[model samples]
Target: MSWRIHHVSLPTRDVRETAEFYTEVLGMAESSPPWKDQDRGEFDIDLAHVAWFQGENAQVHLSRHSRNFARDNNFHLDPIINGHVAIEVDDLDAVRERLRRKGVYFADPGNWALSGLDQIYVLDPALNAVEINSQLK
Candidate 1:
């Protein structure tokens, strides 16, 4: 399946500062998050604590760290605990099938963060969380 780095998420204590640093200092333009107006459903994220920056090919997501967000939401793998690299795959089902065959446990959050994204989380060998997602048609 075709795969590409969609975005890299970073946890910060202050979302506005981090966003300013990325935009003013790093020269990345601020981008609107897809979930801006959409309800998070059960994800329970504060939009005020999040920001997005656009790169040439990929994006950067900054979020305020919250220890309770994952546990409160009952997520097996916390996408923002530390941070995560989001990979966009051409076929999400194919990736899920491969993970199942390999006995890799994945947490399907299913578009909780972004609209039209079918997302799942997996831990890498180093125990770092990784997000695999595909755009829904």
Candidate 2:
């Protein structure tokens, strides 16, 4: 299974302002379908306000800061960081099996509320969260 660094996430108090900054100052363009959406029960989350910015190499996800999204292993590593690193994978099942064989633990190869992109969260040795998204095949 091939893995690629997809994007980096950051938590912000003001998603619009942050998005604009990334676009205007950093030259990152706003990604299409900038909002997160979901059915009532596809996942359990507070329906955070978020946006995405696209750079040359990777995308940037901006989520609004909130205490409920915090986790012990969150890369600082909870929702507290600028955000988490996302890895896009070709074979999620193979990757999961490999991680299992190596005794690595993870959570939620789950879909996003709006995008329906499947992802799983894992922590590094340093407790930094790494998000692995599926190819949806």
Candidate 3:
């Protein structure tokens, strides 16, 4: 079957914060009304509600916590020690500084540069890793 990946859902403790992270830190555009319709609740999906944000090439759907879940469901959601989402930017340092000023903690000031690219890794409010990189000449 032919298919296109319109969006990718990222689970977070706070949908609003996650949406802001994508928009403010990564430069993604938050959708108006900030509401999205998904077939999740109908099929008893794992998420509560999803918010949509537009990136340069693709769209991102931020999943929020639902009432169906219980407090002991920690195992189902653990952002730390897991792989992160990487995004490319024109100015890595500037983005890094912006995130820092927003009280974000970067794993390092700047990681190694390879193949003419500068990189810095950071985490969102939910502890999801975010790699911000720049294409260097």
C-alpha root-mean-square deviation, candidate 3: 13.7
lDDT of 3 by residue, 43-115 (tens): 2223234456676665666666455443333233332234346576766667867877998666542434223
Model 2 weakest lDDT span, ten residues long: 71-80
Q: Model 2: runs farther than 4 Å from truth?
A: 32-48, 55-57, 70-82, 114-116
What residue pairs clash in candidate 2, if any at all? 9-83, 10-82, 11-82, 37-113, 37-114, 74-77, 74-78
TM-scores for all candidates: the values are 0.88, 0.71, 0.38
Worst 10 residues of 3 by lDDT: 34-43
How big is the positional error of residue 115 in model 2, measured in Å on the Cα after superposition? 3.0
The lDDT of each candidate is: 0.84, 0.67, 0.53
Better of 1 and 3 by lDDT: 1
Q: How far does residue 113 in candidate 1 sit from its true spot (Å)?
A: 1.5
Clashing pairs counted in every model: 0, 7, 0
Q: By lDDT, who's the top model here?
A: 1
Model 2 lDDT per residue over 1-137, tens place: 57788788887888888778887998776765433353444433333467766777678778786665545223233533547788888877787788899998777636643364677778888788788886555
- Worst 10 contiguous positions by lDDT, candidate 1: 36-45
Error of 2 at 132 (Å): 0.8
